[model samples]
Target chain A: MAERVLVKGTEAIGEAAIRAGCRLFFGYPITPQNELPEYMSKRMPEVGGTFLQTESEVATINMVYGAACTGTRVMTSTSSPGFSLMQEGISYMACAQLPAVLVNVVRGGPGLGDIQPSQGDYWQATKGGGHGDYKLIVLAPSTVQEAVDLTVLAFDLADKYRTPVVIIADGVIGQMMEPVTFPEFRNLNTLPKHDDWALTGANGREKHIVVSFDIDPHVLEKMNLEIVEKLRKIEANEKRWEEYKLEDAEIVITAFGTVGRIAKSVVEQARKEGIKAGLFRPITLWPFPYERLEEISKGKKLILDVEMNMGQMLEDVKLAVKDHARIEFYGRMGGVVPTPDEIFEALKKFLNV
Target chain B: MLMGQILSLAGMFEGKHVTWMPSYGPEMRGGTANCTVVVSDEEVASPVTSQAEVIVAMNIPSLLKFEKAVTPGGYLFINQSVVDREPTRIDINIVKVPCNDIADALGNLKVANMVMLGAVVEKTKVVSLDSIFMALEKKLTGGKASLIEVNKEAIKKGMEAAK
Candidate 1:
């Protein structure tokens, strides 16, 4: 293992992005995620990278969109409300096929709410936040270490697909500190250059126009169909989830992000009590892994969806399980995270224990 | 902000896996601000946790808020200078120390958290005093270079009081 350092998730993710060869960052201050840009502000200049805090979230996203069109591994971070401000820019990036990382360290409520962790942005993240039929490659990391790893993956996945990637994490994961050993510093030296589409002064090559607006109806439909096809391929290959003791479990618990981490403890307690409870953690929130859930659902008595929001991801769990087993949901919202005891009580009610 | 960092460093320096979360509560200072640290032998799952085996409450609200969350037979080290409410839980052990007094005696009330930290290290034996001292030296020098000695003295006073 590499050398372990105790770091907050915000600090770790920023350093991981630096190691992942992301140099240019544009961000606006938002609660629960401000430390991220703080880290970048200190580290980016040291590494000859650009870290600019724009006047507003709208400016940050548009600046990121402009930087990303130049094939720069760029990023912008915000909480729910700030992310809402970036929706138009996000849609433009999706249309322009720009590779950039966006992090939504979600806080509570539908408006300017509390700075506590909440998973209410599930719909905004997974279901095209902007005004378009587009999807972002969203990865939900549970722990601080996973935040680092998934951030590295998010950048790579974004570049590989030539689209934006979202690291949809809650405030808990964003603010938490943990021992993390980053992978050997993958410097920008070893990465592939995106010179083909990159606007590098043409360099004696043909001119490139990075445009999201093609007025022809047929051409726009083709672009939308192409995005649909990419998402289809992604859904097929990138559905990632973890199953714990699903073989003998009669009740399967489904959760993601912080709720999933808390559910692991509940699963451990339920197992010790011989309750035959298991856990399924969705790592990729956008792909919404269901193939394994389908296999686990065959013999399970029930699927309990635990979320910090009120049954946001539960709809997907039902769509995946699809009448094979009864689906139940228990959630705590508005920044009130449930404890293991609370989850266990919910489990008992669902499992009739 | 640095409480969880020092604890996690001490834990990692002891060759253990540790995870922590610091509350950036909107209240900011003097308003129930605290952090949670979990040190274990193996990789810890999830940063979201409810219970603590040992809670070092430096303020009254923290003591009141986190006292019940401590496990049965767990330790609750409170700064008796600010917190006077006797913990209602009988199963847990409470070590109420005059943290502000000791830090003030040592000539720096700002090291009150360090005092409580030293007490936690001595009582829980979760991390060595040497590790914490090393962490303090690093943390102290990284920012305010002048308060290092008084904080160390505060920790020494705390170690003595913890006994």
Candidate 2:
């Protein structure tokens, strides 16, 4: 058995990426997620990988784009504002069908907000952030161990679908240290070959061109249709979620990322007080587990959506439950992490207990 | 921060779930820096807690800030060497340790955190002393390895004092 070691979440994600056969990392320094690039810088050299601190987030994303075109595993990580800067690059990569892993250790948003944990980027990550019609497969992890697991999975998903995959974690998951046992390093020689679409030197064969745009409107429409088809396949297969103490639950709490795990504690607390509360955490934000949530909310009295932002995922929860369950929202905006006590109080007030 | 880290590591070594979350940014540079450590037998849900099972206050500001955060029957270990005030809360168990004085007696003032950690471990049994020693040996490597004996001694003195 692999020995368990205590590791910070940022460093763990870097190690996981390396183990997943990702060799190239390009990112700019950002608050709350600077440790990720720092870890990459030190470990990349040891593993014969390349780690480059680009001049800006814009440059970082484009560097990822260029490296990914060669079919090599590439990744970049940043926080809220830095992620905002990479949206255009992300759209171009999605349209070009380039595979790359992106991590956003989200902090307070809407500009240069405080360097504290927040889930304000839910809409940006799930819905399209950049211009055009493209969707990035988004994975949200609640625990440090889950963060490590999802990072490795992000690379695989990115490569499998020929699209960029994002691991959206909050500052709490980025800064926290936890005990984790990592999987064995993937042999770089054994990784999947992407020779079909990779921009390897055309060795006296038909040249393969990778471009996101075409002057002909009809050709562009055809390319967009292909992307839409790919997204539909992903949506069908990639939906993921978790249910905790939901079998006998009357009031179900729906959350994602950091808020999800925090609400788990609230579930235990509410259960201790005979409140019959449960937790539903969506692990995949883009291909959201809407059907599973709808199935679970069938007999539940209420579905409470909790978040670090002002009711972003609540829209999806409302859509899933529809009129089957009464919906309520409890959120703490601008980087404030709601405590279990506070969330329990809200639940009690809702039940008038 | 080191104390909380060592405790979390020791818990991991004991095959328990543990998480350590530190307060980052400018507040960690010169201001009141703090970290939260949660050790549990089951999977830890939240890394942050409004009420802690135990709180080690190294100074007066921390005691004043977190004294009320202790659960009714929780343990509150205060560093008497720096904190001049007494905790007004009568619901929790308070173990006052002169961490700086003990470390000074051990020929270094840097092991004061370990001294307070010793008191918490002896009182709470959160992790075994053997595990703490192992974690300390693992953490204090290279140039920092030579100070392990003194730190161990400070911890032993803290345990004896807590008794």
Highest DockQ model number: 2
How many clashes does the backbone of model 1 have?
Answer: 0
Q: Write the per-residue lDDT of candidate 1 for residues A1-353, one digit (tens) a residue.
A: 68787778888899999889889889888888989999999999999999998999999999988888778789989999999999999999999888999999999988887888999999999989899799988899888888999999999999888889999888789888887888766767777578888776877899988878899999999988988898898888888887877778888999998888888888888888889888999999888887777877986788899998989999889888998998889999899888888999888887777
Cα lDDT of model 2 by residue, B1-163, tens digit: 9999999999988999999999898887799989999999999998889999899899888998999999999999999999998899999998999999999988899999989888888999999999999999999999999999998998898898899
Predictions: Cα RMSD each: 1.8, 1.0
lDDT of 1: 0.85
DockQ (0 to 1) for model 2 = 0.87
Candidate achieving the largest TM-score: 2
Q: Name model 2 segments beyond 4 Å from true.
A: none
Error in Å for residue A196 of model 2: 1.4
**TM (chain A), candidate 1:** 0.98
Give the lDDT of residue B161 in candidate 1: 89
lDDT tens readout by residue for model 2, A1-353 = 98788998999999999999999999999899999999999999999999999999999999999999999999999999999999999999999999999999999877899889999999999899999999999999988888889999999999899999999998899999998889899999987678888899899877878899999999999999999999999999989899999989999999999889999999999989888989999999999888999999997888999999999999999889988999999999888999988988888888888
Q: Which one wins on lDDT?
A: 2
